[model samples]
Target: AGVSQEFDLSQCVREPIHLLGGVQSYGALVAARRGDAVVDTVSRNAAGVLGRAARDLLGRPVTELIGQEQWDRARESAEAVDVDVDAGADPAATDSGAVARQDGPASSGVLPMTLEGVDGPRLFDVTVHRTGDLLVLEFEPRAEGGPFVFQNFYPRVRRALQKLQGASDVTECCAAAVREIRALTGYDRVVAYRFDGRDGPGQVIAEDRSEGREPWLDLWFPATDIPPQARRLYARNWIRVIGDVDDRTAGLVPERRADTGEPLDLSASVLRTVSGYHLEYLRNIGVASSMSVSLLHEGELWGLIACHGDEPRRLSPEVRAACEFFGIALSLQLAAVAGREEADELARSRRSLASVLARLTSGASDDWMRPGSGLVELLDADGAVLLRGTETVEAGAPLPEALPGLLANLARRGAVGEVWSSDRLPEVLGLEPEEAEAQGVPAGLLLLPFNRDGDLLAWWRHERPAPREWAADPSRPVRTGPGGERLTPRGSAAVYRATVRGRSAAWSPAQRVVAAELWREVSGLLTRQVVALEARNT
Candidate 1:
């Protein structure tokens, strides 16, 4: 048997990075101010550009750093930008006054400003968002190419979107998106990682890499790699970049305000530094710099577009914006592809089910138990059993005599729903290994309820020794070192095999869809049959 360990709640909720309480770790310069616009804290990077240390900048006014003239120009730019913006705003934006009133901009807003650099005054793009009573600002030096050069990339973005729209499936769309993004951003590798569920493991579904790189396609990463809080942050902040992992992080001078003794909330700031554990994890993976664009589906985080570089690499704001645009386009395409595939699968299932219904209505005795019309074939199961009151009809492999009673007890205990499925029946049903083996019972079951009196259809699958190929040993979820037990990413990219036992092939989304539709049709038929029998008796 594969190694198993107890679940740790701490791994899921631990958020050391969020506690840092400042955006000083971001690649660009950052500062936070009170509602009255007094600078509360500034990053070391911003202090360097201003030719002042962090201690000198603390408790100063924003005007002092940008100069009074540039500050006025920035306010004007912000007002103009606000007017041009529509009601559909970015989710990361917040205004202190509006937040106090329980409403505001959906996300941070950007303003064009000029700031004093070591050499001379330089163009900077400033983004501002409110967190609690503080207004956080991020500053990035505007590239020399300017808006004109950034606008030039639009055609390429449009082309990529068009190609994605043309993709017939999710796999093709992801592959195309990664290739296009890697080419646009000049990253060494790009991968589309999709979460299995809200807090489940993530799998590298698609990837594209530069020459001589190892592929991460089909690799699965545990949920502990990205804790719940980090996921929440990702959903709020769509784009995150680590320009250089080796770069030193600059801490806030005071760390907290003298008056309030409260730390600044940098949740929406791009300059927020990640946790040391995450930095170590990335370092272990040999990634010097990386960027991630959150892939959202219906306003929820569905996955991420991960870009990894072997050396320190910085993407201009223009390029990062382009990647974000592509991520949005890819998200839409993924939803469309899934919808189309489900529709096609439903059609096929209806056709197959219709044939079975026709036979049932023809008054053919035992037709319900026949091979093609039986519940087994309808759900693509290895075997099936239908329980109607005291009557039981079975096909394929025989079920254990105790199975029906076990299912009935489950329904009474609220374990049954419209449809209940389990790949490992022994674990789910609490059967000992020896007991399950002695009965020669299958390891998978799907129960579809028909009525309240325990009348249901059960599909069964024989134990299949399916081998899983993992990028590393999944059994050993974490490693211990002198620094203590850390949830590090697997060091080895080589394949590790483990044969899954006491379990059958996993059920797919399409199969579940078919089972649901079949249940509805069968329930209606059973209701009609009962009505006819009651009428005859009367």
Candidate 2:
């Protein structure tokens, strides 16, 4: 793995510049300071040219080399003055003829300097700019080849692949991917944002944050934030790379086509400008630059891998290509892993249900059918009741007289019971005729009835979801003052969305499918468990 290291550029401005299509080692060096202090004097090729021998230049004040003549000239100018130098020349030779670039007015001061290297010669163009208590020196190199374009990310990519292979579970795999992306890109924060819509909103379900940062771990935003239209557009566009969120928008170049009148295909156009809405979102999130890759599962939108940077960053074409490849591989692995886990759970549930049923089909009495509680346990339900409506008998005298009728009606309809207060249920037990209509209790309570050889051996009843106020204002009401100053709790829809309905949970397609499948499986399992238990009793 490649580790990123930062050095104090207070020394100098040095960077590697290589040719695009050619092989060449080119670098630049510059020296600068603040208030007569020798802050930075370094070169990228220092080791190659000066090496340890280059130490001679350190701690030397700029006024020394110029003597009186050039010093006066520099003190008057207060601006950068490029001077040609030959390292081979004698120090005492006036022919050494160096021009001093001053950053102040005459008589103010001058930074006198010379550059020497062990190598035959190196050409540098330096400019000096002064800020409050700080001097900046920029070095521009004149070289045969262009500056170096960083490439060869194979090592980082290889390590990421290895980690992916070693991941034990889905969360770990995603976390590994996020970590690798962040590490590979040198981004401030990289997150694996899975799209979850359960509560009418899309949100981040999982994230692995970098150290020393606030967590966007489980944060959710409204679907309107990334509208369906926007998502569709993003899918068509493939990906987006924002260089600087605060930067001015560049003009969108009208793409030319072979036929003059033919409209350009924005789908494949990388130059299509980003929308203002998206830019605002990025700014709100504190991301200066970002790269988002769409994750697809089963040919549908799965989620995205969002790489965020605290500072503006631009990825080279090669780096972008590498990221795409890595993202695709990760998405495939994630989907496959999730599928396998789901299959395993289903298989386990089926096995448990089969065992429970084996005992019931033997004509076992209700007491022997007790172990069928295993069915409820496997189903993850609060409780399970086997109601043989045709043969049900009330054992407790205090029980409602109409209890059997209510249970029988519920059995007629297929419903999975959820939690609900007694008040929410209709008075199907016929406590009061008028009250039953008003309460609208058991139109038919949720029931899970399984058949045993054409006989209704037992049925399961589940409560309904508890009623809760969707949203409540948090502010306290206050009376108006003399100047009409007042405060009051105005109900907020946003709060309701976040708290009551749990928008994300309510809108999740994946969760819904999972719930439906679980219900169907439990129904079949209950039949088997009850029959098996009855057989054991016999």
The prediction achieving the highest lDDT against the true structure is: 1
lDDT for model 1 comes to 0.68
lDDT by residue (1-538, candidate 2, tens digit) is 1123322321111111010011011222223344564424433333443232224444555444223453334433334432211121222422111111223321111232334445544443333434223333323243333222234677777789888878767778878888887777778877666664311334454565557766665555443344443444343323556667775532211212223332222222222335554565567556788888766665455677887888887654345546766876786788878777767777676676666555544553453236443544444433334455355422212223344455555445433432111222344354443454444332222233443221222222223332222212222122234544222221123233223210111112232233344445445665677798899999
- Runs of candidate 1 exceeding 4 Å displacement: 1-13, 24-35, 51-106, 116-119, 147-149, 253-262, 298-300, 364-366, 400-402, 412-417, 422-443, 463-466, 481-493, 500-510, 528-538
Query: Each model's number of backbone clashes?
Result: 9, 56
TM-score of each: 0.80, 0.47
TM-score result, candidate 1: 0.80
Candidate 2 lDDT at 349 equals 68
For model 2, the superposed segments whose C-alpha errors exceed 4 Å read 1-151, 198-212, 233-238, 247-265, 364-373, 383-538
* Alpha carbon deviation, residue 226, candidate 1 (Å): 2.9
